[model samples]
Target chain A: MNRMILYKEWLKTRWFLLAAFLVLAAGTFYMGLSLSKTVQFNGADKLWEVLVSKETVLLETLKYLPLAVGGLLAVVQFFPETARKRLKLTLHLPYPQGRMMAMMYGYGLAALTILFLLQATVLTVSLRHYFVTELVVRIMVTAAVWYLAGYAAYIWVAAVCLEPTWRMRVVVIVLLAALVRLLFLSGVPESYNGILPWLVLYVLCGQVLIFHSVARFKEGLQD
Target chain B: MKKIGKIFIGLSLALLVLWLVPWVYRIVTLESYSTPFTLYSCVVHDFTSLDRSDARNFRFIDRKGNVYGDEVQPLFYHSILASKGAFPDSLEGIPVTEEMVEHNSVILSAEPKEFNVKKAPVYLLMESVPVRLELHDPEDAFVVRKNGLAVYRMADNTLLEEKTGRFNAALSAEGFRFPANLVAGKPSHHKEYDEGYLLTDAEGKLFHLKQVDGEPVVRHFPAADSLDLRQILITEFTNRATLGYLVDRDNRLHMLRPDGTVIPTEVRYDPAREDLLVVGDLFYYTVKTSDADGEHFFALRSDDFSLVDRMDRPYDFEEEVNLCKYVFPCRLSFTSSDDGWVKPRFSDFSWIGLVVDLLVAVFIIAWRWRRKNTNN
Candidate 1:
């Protein structure tokens, strides 16, 4: 459960991390180099020109690197081998199985946090050469917000994938994501007055699902 | 299995219908381009040669091709015609003078004199009829071009020339009658007329042609609307090999070609080598010049007149040109160099940039996956 042990384990996989960072860095660098000559870099402060200008929003969307990385992290967390290891460890561990799983989820969150910090440091250092004063804060804030979104995804993945019923958890996770997005767009805003209670009901169901997964994990260890 | 699957299928169908319904309704109810406009008069400036750097020193050419440097006022007097075919009876009086105390609205009555002084009082008739024109009161002057071709109302109700020996005086339109009360006059010299008469097409193509055979003829392409350009100065017209020339109104010079093309003097002078620039909804392209030693210039689209990129500039243009917003009174042109071409440089990142992204993506995935596996 030690945070230090989790950090050391993540550090051991530095080679793989280096490769992923290279892919993102190359793409971002290409963008910066291409944009340096255009109005996007030079005319960022011109309100009308920037707002109506082409490629302005496209360049802004590139800053959502963290969210992409987080989705991939979710897939990796759900790998079958990891599920087997968790089940085996719970049987022998003296601590309660649910507590152990919670600790693992915390460990996954810490890894994502470190990845975000690394990305922030790299982006800041690279932007220094451009010397564009107006866009520095916007770019930094964009990176931070997207990284936070990635962390939220990590939390959802950790809670779902540790359950004994892996296939069921996957189906539920996808359906829930889809439903929330739909309800947020249609049910809530279409003057559907009954949507609030339904939303609360959905949240309650989510809580019960997590409680059921924890109970199943403890029972699986006992069996 | 049967009931749950059927429910899922129904839900999917409902969602698809919900999404497509709005789009279908939008297509059915959408109206095509329809913008309404009321007829009004605005005194536009007549420019001969604009230096962009100086407004006061702009050399204004007259209809007779003589250039003069002086300050001319723009007076806009415009109102909706009360009746379409009826001659305007409002302008059926002698122009206000010092002796006419009743006619003088605010200023005291002065001596009735010919328009011979340095700054002459001039007026513009927006929509002209044979008898009456939408005349602006004498007090409301100088929003339109003051030192150019002007039509004012005379006491006799017949349109007369305020200046002697200019050009065709007997020219008339068959369907449209000359408003009787309107009188045509010039400010001081023929060069002042060159500063006023200008033509802008539906595609934002601006042309200021010199009045040859009395008035500059405006022939709109495809369905050409032949409007006699009241005041304009044609500086250069090369029809042989290159069908392009620069025309001036007061001081503003616009570069135009025969094939429905207009490149504003401002865009030809932009510092950045952008592929395109937008003015209102219309787009103007930035491109290199055709001649061996020409610089980067702009060319508008022939059909619908969107921007089309030409080439880059050979020389490094000044940065001050970027501040122009059509509000500033300056001589502007988007010029390009045909001699040399420079490719856009992209050197913001090295090998490190690639390494960073890959590392970051891999690290997050590997770390999270490992944690998930070990915990389970």
Candidate 2:
């Protein structure tokens, strides 16, 4: 049953996920190419100066792409089921409905995690070829927040989509926007180091709000 | 289980309200505010002001609204009193020489933006004894391990064991402990000359360490005890008359003279919270520490480092519009100035906001309950 559910989740999100992967890979490659060109034009020593002494992480293009991908993932996965009332039938299936719902989320999250990790690894490995350890660490730390922004957007979008009623959805949208805004407030390298733990907790806890959506859909509460 | 989900939704809404209420109130109440560019004039022993918007148009006005500058500009330079006057022949009662202005005028600034930014904990210990101060590029950076035990050169990512031993031995012989707490220096090549890093070891003892000709030159400043030192500022003054400012735990400012003597001065600064800017001229060193409240200006004698005058002003924003006091008595904020991280900060709270939130929650629940019964 879990296999079937996972397959259904993949079947629903494969096209969108492929496009997301391509967009992310292209963005990462552009960041690498741009950085290599800078080193080529300015020399490796000057590139070291800007990275170590100054605050240009050279990866600003990757900032909001992950966010859009996350949002679109949630909408694509669940909106069809909700519109066709297929989700209602799934809820009535002969299984613990919670497990079935979680299986669907689990598959989507696994795909996203792999996509984001690959994006990070490619950028970091390429950065290390020219930059030394200290410079590479700073660049990766600065870029980490944007990747986390993707995760936060993904869960928040799920919370919005799962919600059954218009009144609650409106409130969820406002809250999600504010919550995501926190991820991009500061661009200073390593600035996110301390709050990152709490941010992870917030994102995880925010994901729990989707359970509220599931409960509402089961209760058939609509405005 | 379903009730837990409902509670979570309520909690999320409450958190959003906590952040948004104060921000919205601030947006509605925020005003455009400007304060005069204030400087402490040594002649009058009070704060002198120039309109921040119009530097040329503003007269040197005293706290008493007594306007003076036409005569003073000439004294500093016959040209400013003339038009192109650079340095005056004399000040109120003392002779003003071109040499004094050249040596005395220096500026230093400290803000959260500077210290709050994450440091790599790597420094280039340039050869301080060299006649020419050639700065090091980022490629030559090195990390000084706990108590100078090891110095790892970042260029080749190699440890210089023998050199590190000799440097650490010199420091260890001079009552230094292992693992330095604060190592302060300006390693950028853009400076006129490099001043060696000032480090306080684990025991809080101060030592001066710099790399010279591939050898570590360790000098100890016998002036300060380590336990009380809060932060170090290396001014690298051109005249080399003063080393920099040392902030004590009490936030009292002290002038570090070249002879390794710490001269306690009345530059009241909150080393942790406030941003400080020290501007030195021939006559006085104006130390300004600005914060959310406003700005505090302190003028010290350029030669003697005495408190000549002081002035304090509160920004009109806090004074003019304060609806948070009435509406959001207690608020939740996720950002802070004291540190670089953004986390949950609950501050300036009044119970009124909490009570209102409770009312909203009740209304939400009651409204939903009524709708369910009507549908049934």
Candidate 3:
């Protein structure tokens, strides 16, 4: 039954996952090309000096890409189910409803994790070619928060889609906007070093909100 | 499951309310005010400041509330006063010249955000004894590791094994340990000269490292070993009176001389939490340090570092009472004026605001009850 649920989620989001991967690959490729050009025009010494002295990681393009992919993937996977009222039938399947929902969310989470890891690996490989290990690690630590923001975006969008009432959906959206703002308050590299663990906890606890929306749907509640 | 979800949602909403309500209140009641720029005047033998409260015309006032027009300009604005041919021929029986004022005057500022940042552990060691008497950036950079220093040629990112071995041997001979605790230097060719880097080893022993004539010049200063050093700042002031400033664990400021002597100054400065400004002339050094509470001014004689005068200006509290404490139980901020790191900080909790919070809750409940009755 879990395989069937996972397969259904894959069938719904296969194209989107492919597009996200391609978009991420193109971004990484562009970053690599730009870095190579900089090293070619001005010697590697100047490039290293800029990286050490400046507050930039040269990965600003990837900042919002993960967030966009996560939000869009949630919409692609769940919007049709809610819009066509097919979620009610899915809830009535032979499997336990809680397990069913968990499997669906787990599949999405797994796919996103795999995609984000690939992106991180590409960044590490490319950055290491021109920078030392310490500098490369600094960039990775700075980019960690953006990837976490992606997961939070996915979960919040899922919660909004599953909500039965329009008023509550709007409320969830406002709260999600505020919450996402917290993840991007500072542009200084590694500024989130201290609060990253608590932010991860917040994202994990937020998974329960989707269950609340589904529970409302089960109660035959609608606006 | 529904109950748990509702509780989480309530908690998230409460966090937002606590963080954002006070933020909005402060923004709405924001006022524009700046601290006056105060400097000690040798002529008046007291502190003088420009009163800018009246934007149309600024008045120069002494500490004793005596206002002066334009005649006192030569005391502070020596260059401009000299250009106007109103320069003093002699003051306090010492002859004054524009060249002397230009050379002796120095301004040093230190802010918390500048020091409270994480930086990459790579340093550019400029050549101190350049071929043409002008400092030039070196082709190699060094990183201190647990074993020793490793020099990498920035052009190809390859190790300079011979140079690294030479410097490592010199450091070992001087009893320097690996894994430095703090490395401070002015790493720019724009400076008058290069002083290389001042480093504290793993055991907090201070060592001065510089490159002269393409070789290493390492000096160990054992006088600082007894002091628990927290930070060191290298200065290349035009006067060349001192090498740098050393901050000890007790928040005391010390002047480091090129001859390996450290003299304690009479200024109270905490580099981690305060902003420091030092304005020096030929005779006296006026140091200003500001923190959350207020600003402190210290005047020290330039020759012996003795305290001449001191003053304090506390921040105004009446400006903070404009509905902030009454509306916000606590303020939440991610960025701070004291540091550059972005982390959550909840401060200034007001028990009075809890009464307002309760009233808001009662109002919300009453409105909800009325709405339910109307629907019925």
Candidate 4:
């Protein structure tokens, strides 16, 4: 039954997952290629020096790609389902509603994780070919918060979708926006370095927000 | 379980409101007042302020009612001239000249380095091009790791095995241990010559580090046993003034000379909050430090670190907010001007918010109890 639910969720998200992957891949490649052209013009040594002294993270263009992809993925997968009350039909299945909801969200999350890892791996490999391990890690660590913001977006957008009224959704969205802003508070590279593990925990705990929305939805608190 | 989740969300929303409302109100209504740009003068035996609090208006005056450059250029130019010995008869009748001020002037600043938010300690060592103070294209950059255990070049991201080995060996030869405490340097092309970095070893000993001809040059400086050194700043001044100032564990400032010696200055350091500016002329080294308590100006002679004159002014600037603070006596701010961190830090505390919270709580409980009694 969970497998069937997972299949249903995949049916909704598979195309978005592909598009998100390609967009991120293209962005990563463009940045790496730009760095290559720069190095060709002014040797790798100068580039490394600027990164060290100025804390310049060369992959700034790619910073918002994951965030945009995550939020869009959530909207694509859940909005239509909740729009026509399709979730009501799914709830009537013999499978427990909680398990069914978990299966659906879990599948979407797993797919996003795979996409982000793909993006991370491709960028890290390309960066390593030119720069050293320390710079490579610094770039990756700086991207950690933006990537986690993807999961937060997914979970929060799911809550907004589960909400049964426009008034509640507006308030919830404002709160979600404030929450998202927290993830991007500092553009200083690696400002999020030591705080990442706890941030991950905070994002994971945010999963409960959607469960609360689901409970409220089942209570039929409609506008 | 569902009820608990709902309550958790409610509490979080409340906390967010608690943090936001007061901060927003204060931001919208608060008026700002700051003291003038002040510097100490040994010649005048008081603080000299360039007061420009009013827009498009400025006055240069001593605390003793002496004024300078009333109609044209400010008296600051005259002070600068005196400090540099250009003005034979200074406004305050001090004996100074250009040559004496050029060689003797030094700046000792002690603004604590805030590492609350970590940045990659990556530095670009610009090539020493022909012109001094001219920024050069970087040939390489470097980061010291694990207490100077290794120095890796950033270009190809490889260890400059020979340079690293030389530095490590030199420090070991100097009887210093691994994992240095503090490493300070200014690696830009904007200086006369690079002093490289000042490293304090694991056991709190001082050493100088510089790169010459792509080689590591290390010099060990015998330090005072009570040094408890915390931070260092390296200035590549034209006069090759003292290497830089160091802040010790006891919140005291010291100067490190070029020949690897230390002089404990009379300046007090407030690690919590310290803003210091040191100006040097041929005759006196004027140091100004400002903090919550007030502004302190001290002038010490260039030859010996003896207090020539001192000024202590009490700045109770917070009293300006006493009337309007009833609206917000305290605010929970995640980030502070002092450091770069987004953690819950309560600031601007007063008795106002406490009384308000207690009163609000009492009213709520009383209303709930009254409702229960009416139902019974």
Name the candidate that leads on TM-score: 3
Give the winner by lDDT: 2 or 4. 2
| Interface RMSD for candidates 1 onward, in order | 25.2, 3.0, 1.6, 2.5
* Model 2 C-alpha lDDT per residue in residues B303-332, reported as the tens digit of each score: 788887777877765456556655554778
DockQ leader: 3
Error of 1 at B323 (Å): 54
Model 2, runs deviating above 4 Å:
A43-48, A51-56, A129-138, B51-56, B73-87, B92-95, B124-138, B144-176, B313-318, B336-339, B354-376
Compute each candidate's TM-score over C-alphas.
0.32, 0.87, 0.94, 0.88
Regions of model 4 farther than 4 Å from truth: B53-58, B70-86, B89-116, B123-138, B316-330, B349-355, B358-376
lDDT-best of 1 and 2: 2
Model 3 is docked with a DockQ of: 0.64
The reply for model 1, stretches above 4 Å from the true place, is: A1-16, A36-58, A61-64, A81-85, A96-99, A131-134, A166-172, A175-212, A219-223, B1-376
What docking class should model 3 receive?
medium
lDDT of 4: 0.71
Compared with the true structure, what per-residue lDDT tens digits does model 4 show for residues A1-223? 7677878888888888888888988898899889989888877877776666564578888878878887898898889878888978887889888887788788778888999998899888988887767778988888888899898888888878877878767766876787677787766767666567877887787777777777878888888
TM-score of chain A of 3: 0.98
Candidate 2 local lDDT, A91-144, one digit each (tens): 888989878878877777788889988988898789778655666787788777
Comparison by lDDT, 3 against 4, better one: 3
What lDDT score goes with residue A124 in model 2? 79
Alpha carbon deviation, residue A108, candidate 2 (Å): 1.3
Docking class of 2: acceptable
lDDT of 3 by residue, A1-223 (tens): 8789999999999999999999999998998899899889987888777777778888987899888888988888888879998899899999899999888888888989999999999999988887777778889999999999899999999999999999879878978898789888877778888889999999989899899999999998998
